[model samples]
Target: MNEDSLQHPKLERQPMEPRALKSIILSTITIVCAVTACIPLFSVLIMLLYRGGKRLTFQLFYTLPPGAFDAPGVGGFGHAILGTAFMVGIAGLISVPFGILAAIYLAELGPHHKVSEIARFCAKTMTGLPSIIAGVFAYAMVVLLMGHYSAWAGGIALSLLMIPTVMLTAEEAIKMVPNPMREAAYGMGCTPTQSLIKIILPVAMPSIITGVVLAVARAAGETAPLLFTALFSESWLAPNNPTASLAVLIYNWSSSPYQNLIELAWAASLILVVLVFFLNIISRAVGGKTKL
Candidate 1:
């Protein structure tokens, strides 16, 4: 043995533990399964891009759908885009205030009350409610009452779906505010209302906005509800008439015998996917900004 060997002796390598080997095997399987799951998603995205990218044009964003006798690729779904935005805006108006109020009640004012418990349970149950049921409900309540399909009916339909998501998320976000912050506010002579308005709301706003955006995204992509409520329009969006939406347009066009309509459907699908993806990115950005 040399001087170097005296300073640092070589140690014998031990065999891998059975538990360690099992963990490695399981982890590898998990990774493989995750990759396999992503394959279909990536494949669909690729197909959308390849089939839809070529059809995108400036005119497509502003022009109306082609007439029955018109040539292929002569029109667009601008009305549908506007109609989707209009209905979603209406939904936000109807849902946001109600949801926030309910959240405040559940998370702060009457958190331990029986009513709050029941309200919370109902919200959770609505989360899993079928979208088509909401449509039917809206049709019965709004469309039938008004005696026609209109954007208002569509908005009401979307609002039903949006409310539960917003209420649940806002409640969770409000609950996540630190107890220390609440205590500090109370100690500093702040009333419960003042503290909630000035401190709690501002702190939880990002997360609440995240939920709102997600709800809007879901509403924008819904077709069944719109079909039962708004129906479909080929002309410009009118408040008193049936309105178009990208979701309904995709459904109507995708099955058409005309090649152009099918292509436009693909394009509409791509646009809808991109819009949802963008909303998700915004939600992540806003949610990540606040630690609470």
Candidate 2:
């Protein structure tokens, strides 16, 4: 063929066909949908910063909630802050080990076995359940038994919410390890157990840590579960006592008629959002350092 004919092949300057045009349209739609989905998140962050940023003060960090409506005082949510930490700590204690072990079993031992399949199915199913259902489960199992709401009940409810998240994330992390890495360890006479403990787990640690942190973040902001399990306490109390939380405090104060309480709720919401943001940052940092 002549150079001109070769340069002007049948497809050279042809427009995209109907099928390709439709695909391009669909892809644009997908992008638009994804961007649209983020609008609410952006709106919330903006609203929280605007409403809450102005209300923050040193006293907001150290003081307790206001006293009775008749003799209201300038105070903050120190009790709720401490209560949130206490319950989340308890949740971490319960969920972290159990989740890691379950992930190990699923990824390192019998990923395709019947029992593993059953476990994975359950985890997936549990992940779909509402936070309120977890609260109800904890209420029936712990509150009914104890005859009252307590931080323990709240912790358990949060743990239930954390487990499936950690499990699925950790399992996928472990599975991401190369098959050749295990083979190399085996060639060096490492037992499966040793290889798993020394190689696989270390390799997977960053992702596992990230997963656990994310789960903890999710647990930290849960309100419905704490409402059913902790029932809210404004007074300073032990972990065994009914506890207040940032989420529940926000929920309560947001609905209150008092302007000050509403302001406090806004502040608490900002703090919670900041805390979750930091946790994510820490996770990314940890994950990055491990890979490096």
Candidate 3:
């Protein structure tokens, strides 16, 4: 062949492919969108820190809210902080086991079955369900049974909101484990249950933790559900008692006629935002450690 014909035609066309150009364009758009999304989030964080940082104090974590109309430095958010921790902890306890187990059933034990499909649909649906609806459900189910609002009831409401996210995340994580690993476990005389308990769960643990952290972050920032079920208290949160939460306190105090309480509210808002931010960071770290 002549020199001109001998050089591959594909080499000449490599730089001008329409498909490659399209992919570059699409990737650039995705990056721009992601950066754009982060702007509003960083703006919120800065705003909260500026508005609330002045009111944050050591006492904020150790003492109760002070007398009405007290100065900004006089009172703290101890009750709200404690209550938030307790209520969210209870919610975590209630949701994590059920969500993980259900995810295991769907992803590892019964993939492609009709019942699993139905359950997965229900979980995905719940993931989008309004937080207030979960609150209402908890109110009707738990509060009506007990005749009053309590921290446990608030937890039940939050668990409902948390469960769907956890289930979806865990299911996705479990699925990320390769089919070969499962087959190997089966090859080694492991029962399906034993394989799930040992091989699948251990492999998926990091991602599952990431999911739980994200779910808790979402639950922590919620207020509408707590409004209906938590029934905020200004005082200490007992286990079976209606209790204050940081979000609830922020909502109520932000509109106060007194500037000090308003400042306290701002501070609580900052704390809540920080906590959620921390959880997100942990989730990201754990997710990065996963091989996938």
Each model's C-alpha lDDT? 0.94, 0.90, 0.90
Error of 1 at 172 (Å): 0.6
Q: Candidate 3 on 168-227: residue-level lDDT in tens? A: 999999999998999999999999889988898988999999999999999999998889
Strongest candidate by lDDT: 1
Residues 115-219 of candidate 1: C-alpha lDDT, one tens digit per residue: 999999999999999999999999999999999999999999999999999999999999999999999999999999999999899999999999999999999
Residue range with the least summed lDDT across 10 consecutive positions in model 3: 7-16
| Runs off by more than 4 Å, candidate 3 | 1-39
- Which candidate number would show the highest TM-score if scored against the true structure? 1
Question: Which residue pairs come into collision in candidate 2?
Answer: none
Question: Which portions of model 1 show Cα errors greater than 4 Å?
Answer: 1-16
217 in model 3: Cα distance from truth in Å? 0.5
TM-score of each: 0.95, 0.87, 0.88
